[model samples]
Each structure stands twice: as structure tokens, then as C-alpha cells.
Target: MAVRVDLNLSLDGIAMPANQTAENPMGEDWGRLVAAYVGTKTMRERVLRDTTGEGTTGVDDRYAAAYFDGVGAEIMGAAMFGLHSFPDDPDWRGWWGEEPPFGYPVLVLTHQQRRTIDFANGTRFEFLSVSPQEALDQALRLAGGADVRIGGGVGTVRDFLTAGLVDRLHVAVSPIVLGQGTSLWDDLRSFDLGYAVTSELSEAGVNHVTFAR
Candidate 1:
């Protein structure tokens, strides 16, 4: 099974915005960075659970549709799971509501251990404090031979990449530039050493880049 990473970032490689606060968790810059991806019909149908069929179609939607294909399990950092925003709030399930888009197991990498949360549509969240390899091992078991996705907020993806655990990485680079924020490529110099790079510009003005090893 392939270890994949699909993410959207600013032109400057910023995965998270600098002005993030409790008032604006995603921050103002997040919208611009992920506009193309969120505007797709696939995202609308899956993440938003919108059955209205009222979103963009074509290249962007194609990539958005491929995001969830064959992904049996997901591994994400605590921040991505909304733990950073509500550290003490035990009731905070995640950014996704009752029925999360991921219809599989989710391993939340966090220092603070919590009981496993099972949601509707077979989405299970298991908080764990383990190394990247260990986390992947658990995810693989939960994946049932399907691919393990490295869902991210920058730090987690970088950790897996540094550990040489990722096999396929797809990055959608938006046109906007967030001058300061969490960067995905900070310590990832020569990260594409063993991967073959491919790029394509979509109609939404986002660059669809993929690194496959």
C-alpha cells in the first residue's frame, strides 16, 4: 500500500496562516490558499456533504475526486484534527461534524491520549502518541491493505517525509503568497531525490504537482 499525502498550500509553501486565532481558526489566508480545492464539486459533495451538485467541474474537480480514492486510513497531526484549538475541550470531536468525509479509520497523532471516538459512516478517530513509523503501522492494519494517507497541517507531513515513509505526494499550490506561516518545505531540502516530479496547471489557477517514488 502506498503512503500518500494530498494537500493544498500557498505559493510560498505556507500550509497554515499566520493570523490564526480562536475567533478565526483557519485564518483569513486559509480561504485563498484552498479556494480552488474547496470550490470543486468533489469537495462540495464529500467534505460539505452537499448533494446539490452546484460546484465547479473539470481539472480541479478531477484532482479533488482523486483525493479520497483508495484511501482506507488517514494519519494526521493534532492541529489538523482541531486539538490545538481546543486542547482542554474533551468534547471537541474535530473540524468535521457528525459525519466526517473520510469514511475510514483516522489516526490522530497527539501527545495527549484520548479514548477512541467512533463516528457515523465508519470514521473512527484514535489518538496516539507514537513515532511516524509506528503510527503508519497501526494505520496500515486499519487500512485493510488499502493506502494510508498522510493528512496534514504541514508538520505531520514533514515528519513522515523526513522519516522516508511517504510514497506518493500530491500538492496543490495556490497562486497567493502567505509571507509568513507554517511552511511545508522548510527542512525538506532535497526531498524529491527519489521521487519523479510532475506538474500541471488547472483552470482554477492552482498548480497540481505530484511527486511519486
Candidate 2:
């Protein structure tokens, strides 16, 4: 099975906002970076679970739809799972409400041990303190022959990339620039040298870039 990473980052390669507070979990820069993806009709239907058919339907929507394709299981960091800001809040589910978009199993990587959470939908979250390889092994087992997606908050993606565990990676580079934030390419110099790279400019102005090995 293929291990893929799909992410949205600023023009400066910042994946997460520098100042993320409880009031603004994704931070102020998050809106600008993911505006295009969030505005797509596919995101509205899938993530928002809206049947209103109220969103843009074009190149941006096509990329947004592709994001969820072939993804049977997901592995994400605690921050991506919304545990960084609300560590003590046991009732905190995640940024996504009751019914999350990811209908597949999700493995959350965290230092602290916690019980597994299963939603009414097919979304099952299991917390693990293991290394990237260990977590990927568990995720692969649950993936059911489909590809496992590396859903990230920057650090998680970097860890997988550094360990050479990712086979395909797609990054939507927004036109905005975040002067300060957690960067995805911090120590990843020449990381794309071995991968076949391609880029396409979406109608919303974001560059849809992909790296496949």
C-alpha cells in the first residue's frame, strides 16, 4: 500500500500558524492558506457534510475531491487532532464536530497515553506513543489494502518524510506568506531530489504540487 501526505502550506512553506490559541486553534494564518480548499464544493459536501451544493465547482473543487480519494486510513499528530491546545480536556473530540469527514480509521500520535475513541461513523481514533514506523504499521493493517494517508500538522509530516516512509506527497501552496510559523521544509533540504515532481496552478491561485517516488 502507498503512504501519502496531503497538506496545505503558505508560500513561505509554513504549514502551521505561529500563534495558535484556544480561541483560534488553527491560528490567523490558517484561513488564508486553506481558503481555496475550504471554499470548494467538495469540501462543503465531504468535510462540512452539507447537501446544499453551495460552493465553487472548478479546478479547486477537483483537487479537493482528490484529497480524500483512495485514503482508507489516516495518521496525524496530536496537534492535527486538536490535542495540543486542549490537552486536559478529555471531552474534546477534535476540530471536526460529531461526524468527521474521514470515514476511515485515524491513528493519533501523541506522547501521552489515552483510550481509543470510536465515532458512530467509521471514524476510529486510537492514540499511540510509538514511533512513526510503528504507527504506520498499525495504520497499514487497518487500511484494508487501500493507501494510508499522512494527515499532518507539519511536525508529523516532517517526521514521516525524514524517515523516508512517505511514497507520495501533495502540497497545496497558497499565495500568501506567513512571516513566522512552523515550517514544513525546515531541515528537509534536497528532500525532493529523488521524487518526480509536478505542479499545477489552481483557479483559486494555489499551486497544487505533487512529489511521487
Candidate 3:
């Protein structure tokens, strides 16, 4: 089965989560920018509680690693891949420093033309100007049934979900709250997607909710 997972943070009472990312792990401030999307305090509470401390025993990095262990490829939007424009004068790689999070072949959806970026850890960034379907098809072909992760900045996940391409999801709802920003479901006209909770964990204020579609 094909699967695409999306994750985010938000305020309580809302349906989706917010988008909040600090400059870096240990940056200027403790926590500064707050990009709101959706979700509720209750939801955020659940997600944060599951990603830290003892709750991370069988969760977090281990769980995520296992999920992508033998995975074929990954599909990520260009915006999520980097913060600057492609084909620039200096050519910035990404915000993930040297080693990236994903080690598989990641197809980046972008309109700008650029050559593929190969990292030392075996993750190659292939830019694609085609549609979501095309990128997904390519991912599935390389996935070999393991699992194709739809790493996103929100819009990419919605595209796959609306097209009925996601089969399973592991959403990490954070504890922070952003009063206003882009929402995961803001443009969604319907919520017909059904998901059964497979597993749940609460630790360090992050709730990890795994769902099977």
C-alpha cells in the first residue's frame, strides 16, 4: 500500500496543526517565530507528549527510522527542501547542514530548473517540475512497496491526500501554539478522509499519532 504522512503543530480546537520552526536548534532566541496553521491545544498537547523523554523509547527517531527503513524514495516540495531560490549564484544546498534527514532518493517538486544534488549520506535531490501524480508515481516505482514518505511544507501533503494517495499517517502534533499562519486544512474543502488510530504516544509535550487509512 502507498502511504504519505504529514505532520505539524497548531492551537487547540482547530482541525489541523500550525507551522512553527525556529531558526535552528540553538539559535538567537529560545522560541521566536510563530506561524499558525490550524489544530487545537488539546491536539498539540497530545503530539508533544509523545516525542520526548520516556515516551520516546519506542518513538521519535527510532520509530521514524524504522518506518523509512528499506523505503524506496521520498517526495518533498521545493519550498520545504530549501529556503532560497534554485540555480542561484552561490547555490545553497539546504538548511539541514551537511547530513540531511532523509537518506533515500528524494524528488523535490519545483518550477526552477537545477541539477540534481547528491549528498555524501546517499540522499540525492532530484528536482521535478511535473505534477504531484508524476512525482508520486516515480517515488512508488523506487519504493518497492516499503513506503513512500511525502515530506512536506503542507501543500504537498494536501495534494496527495486529496488525490487519495496516502494509506497511512504518522502525525506529530507539537505543543507550541501559533495564533495565525498557514493551515494544513485551510484550503481543504472536505474532510472525507478516514483514519483509524494504530498507535499513540505522549511524551515531552509531543503527541505521536499513527493512523491507518
Give every collision pair in model 2.
none
Q: What is the C-alpha lDDT of each candidate?
A: 0.92, 0.90, 0.61
Give the per-residue lDDT digits (tens) of candidate 2, residues 42-75: 9989988889999999878888988889888999
Off by over 4 Å in 2: none
Q: Residues 1-213, candidate 3, lDDT per residue (tens digit)?
A: 466674644433132324434444222221322212112232223333323333223344444445455566899877677633334533768666666656778898988777888899878888889888888889888777767888875677878877777777666655665555455666555443477775454444456666676
Model 2 — TM-score against the truth? 0.96
Query: Which candidate number would show the highest TM-score if scored against the true structure?
Result: 1
Question: Using lDDT as the measure, what is the rank order of every candidate, best first?
Answer: 1, 2, 3
Candidate 1 vs. truth: CA RMSD? 1.0
TM-score of each: 0.97, 0.96, 0.71
Tell me how candidate 2 scores on lDDT.
0.90
**Per-residue lDDT value at 17 in model 2:** 82
Q: Comparing 2 and 3 by TM-score, which wins?
A: 2
If both were scored by TM-score, which would come out higher, candidate 1 or candidate 2?
1
